[model samples]
Target: MDLIQRLDSRDADFASQLSRLLAFEAEQDESIDRAAADILADVRRRGNAALIEYTNRFDRMTAASIDDLEIPRADWHAALAALPTAQRNALEAAAERVRIYHERQRSETWTYTEADGTMLGQQITPLDRVGLYVPGGKAAYPSSVLMNAIPAKVAGVAELIMVTPTPDGTRNPIVLAAAAIAGVDRVFAVGGAQAVGALAYGTETLAAVDKIVGPGNAYVAAAKRRVFGTVGIDMIAGPSEILIICDGKTPADWIAMDLFSQAEHDELAQSILLCPDAGFLEDVRAAIERLLPTMPRADILRVSLANRGALILVRDLQEACDIANHIAPEHLEISTEAPEVWAARIRHAGAIFMGRFSSEALGDYCAGPNHVLPTSRTARFSSPLGVYDFQKRSSLIQVSQAGAQTLGRIAAELAYGEGLQAHAASAEFRLDKP
Candidate 1:
């Protein structure tokens, strides 16, 4: 599974080639869209009754009552005690790092008063309620619990509700323990589009949330898109992706392993390398060939590399930087002499790894930054979930007698230009002269 093309040779159609390379993300999963829409519509129209029916049908869990939706406190404690001491400690440590990082991101409300008696400021407030979805069963992610809930906690969101899919309507001990560590206020055993629906539109047991976050399958993403207006969503995340930029100094095995990290996620996952040296690219390819056979997800990795992965040879480091900025991968690893020098040029990316030592796995678990990020080139326009995601900002303005007179004239003029007579009249009335 290898792709090699000289940068100069593709110059004539480079734009279209780049466009095509980045365009795979535009291919929507209509099946997921249709399925999620049906579930959302049903839940919106019928409320808990529809939610229960769909959960039973899809999740195969008979949640007869709203009480069945939430995991009990006793269960949570039992799960925490059940984990091995080392794993529990790791979770605790990860939680601490996550909380500390987000604490710095916390915002405060402020007000400013001018000499002219005009007051202007910004008010920062946390959402009253939020919903976090943690994938369960084989896809259970304890790290996601820390990434999603800690930010809301730092932002001071009052009620942080967590929902995870359970094949048998049972919660995972690790997930429960992680949620507890992360300070998730509530736990529910509901997943997929239906869980998202329950959060967007309140069910009897699960209260409606101001925002929904965490990663999910294609169906889950589609559900978030559908319920966007009903409740807030972090982003419509796509398949995971990673790009490694090296200058031939790094070990081929290390580079190959990093590519495999994201490749094992899914067949659609992309792992690309942008390097100026063709010889190094061949070494990385040889490493992949030798190593791919030993990995457990070889089938998935092979398909991912063959279809989504590529190793493009550029003319120089500048060309590599240009291509990386255009791709804007979710995880970009710059393995170079001065990674920081190239890092400053990167204007867009979800999360950037600075050196060879900073692997994608580091960012996934213990790194200070959030692992939940925009995928499939969405990094160009979106950002990772952070303290800001859980907080809302309000513009503050106050007008004194003189300040109103000073500003109302311009306001009236703009309103009049838009043919909003009532708007103009309202501003004029505030500054009306006797």
Candidate 2:
């Protein structure tokens, strides 16, 4: 079998082939959904008792009470202090960069008054509390902690609560240290649907959060979806995807590694390249063959690349840009001579890495943008998580008497047209009688 799929825009069946490649229908597993719903209901009904039962059974914990799952603030600081100098420095640096970037996104309340003394504005306020879920099973992503929590703190969230599964009672210290660095108010070792339930429906020990933001596995994702109405949730991200638009001027090795970055994430993750040069495409193909063996995640890279990755030859840079708009990928790398020229044409993407040197990996770490991006073509409408997600806006209005005279008439007329007598009467009540 070929190491990875290859296609040409000139092919007659190319459109259908590209559609097939992009198709990633997340199967709604009824069984999983039911299980999650049951767990949520249990948590909602029994509260702390059910929380302890599920945590103990699923994560192999022996907690006598919900209090047992709470990680002390002292432990968070101690985790920070205990980190090796290099890791600690990198974590702090990444946190600071993320904080600085998110601060720029903080929404502020603004008001404007008309000549008639009518005032209208939007009032921005932070969420009272937020829940951050960090996946703690396969790998410890301290970076997830930093990305999810720092933005909430930057938005002036009053309290930040974190939940991560500590399977077999094993907690990842780095994640704890990140909690300390990110100013997380509380850390709970409970995870899975139970943790999400606890966050959405407040328990005796853990209060319900205004919103929950983070990534998780199948059950956790299903749980997030189930509890969305009870508590706001971040996007249910699909497999990570990266689309690179190369003018075939960048190094083949660089392009290959960039593709590998997302592919190595998992077997479902996707990476693709769009270039005009056939010769350069071959060079990148050769580069992928040469470098795949050296990666620690070569097996995952191999499977993901073979299954979902693609290399396409476009007619020109403009064509590549057009195709990128069609895909609306989560991560876009415009690795051409004048990247901005093509990036300007892009209508949609979660994040655009301009120039060859700006690898997607950098953005995942200290690059000052949230790596939690909209995946699976969701970039067409949604956006990356930021301070904006942690805060809400309320429309402010204070109508002057003269303004009400006009607005009330309009409102009553429309209300009466709709046959809502109460609404019409309410509006008419504010008007001066003839």
Candidate 3:
């Protein structure tokens, strides 16, 4: 009964209770931030020397220079070839699907001429270079490599540089294989805030990147926060979250396991279920109790479910949609008879898994959609990582003399209204210039 918070929409304090359960203010540990700041500063000041020093001290490497950390192109190809047949095939399959999906998102340079001969349009161009940070050591996730790198390549990025820590000189072959499959241009065996700093501010050998992507530990997040202006970065991600709206038709066991998918992510991750049927809620509770002990990360699941997870009794599917919009969770699964009907009613969520068959886990790996999504209720305004994130847009303006006469007058009027006579003169000069 105490596994997770239980709430009823009929209760007077239900809204307040749900708010408290959903609230998650990630710890801004000043110490970690300060440490990250110091590392970034050192790397920016000393370049390759600082990068090698941190790589040696933190990852236990004895590299003499930058060349020692740069993984050769042939090594990436070797890793790809060395992968077991099934693993290699799966990585390629995932990469191909991601590429296909993101290729549709690539924007092109477009322009249209007006009647007055003013050509206006948006020109889309890929970044010159980008940095991808992959978590190394025991947290190697080859899937993440596909999710981050494939989109950049699909966006026509010229160069994709990947930096992953090799703790104790142990490189994750799977990650390397993924990078090769994703068409990454380069690989470096370095990580941490130092890697981020080196990417943002070029080292002696490594050129600076225009943008950086991929997920990492707390230090990586802090480093991204510090280097936002110097280089474009993906969002500062928060703890994962999953919310399921079941109409009691789906099996309770299915719903229970669905909740466990995100809960297993970490102790801070959250999972919640909204159902109109009280009996089904209890059935899911029993299923959670039965399945929790069997999980390898049962301890983490217990802490996560106990602290942030919830089972709420909503008035109906309509009310469930309303509550879901309020929560704006990272992942939403509409497990019901007609998920589309309810999905249409919903307005906010990072990714929606419709029907009983569409699980959130599938979306995380190979659902043809980018898994790097907005979190911490950021779905309200932000979006998942895609080719668009790797591309930038510039406005095209070619005004003919006649067209300029009109546009210039408008601009000059506004500029003069804001109080500058020079602006008015500029427009007046162009008004009748032969």
Q: Summing lDDT over every window of 10 consecutive residues in candidate 3, give the lowest-scoring window.
A: 425-434
How much is the lDDT of residue 170 in candidate 3?
Answer: 94
Prediction-by-prediction clash tally: 0, 0, 0
Candidate 2, residues 273-389, lDDT tens digits: the string is: 999999999999999999999999999999999999999999999999899999999999999898888888999999999997999999999999999999999889999999999
Clash list (residue pairs), candidate 3: none
| Tens-place lDDT digits, model 3, residues 186-248 | 999999999999999998889999999999999999999999999999899999999999999
Identify the runs in model 3 with alpha carbons over 4 angstroms from their true place. none
State every prediction's TM-score relative to the real structure.
0.94, 0.98, 0.98
Give the whole-model CA lDDT for all candidates, comma-separated. 0.85, 0.94, 0.92
Q: Could you give me the TM-score of model 3 versus the true structure?
A: 0.98
> Candidate 1: how many backbone clashes?
0
Worst 10 residues of 1 by lDDT: 1-10
Q: How accurate is candidate 1 locally (lDDT)?
A: 0.85
Off by over 4 Å in 2: none
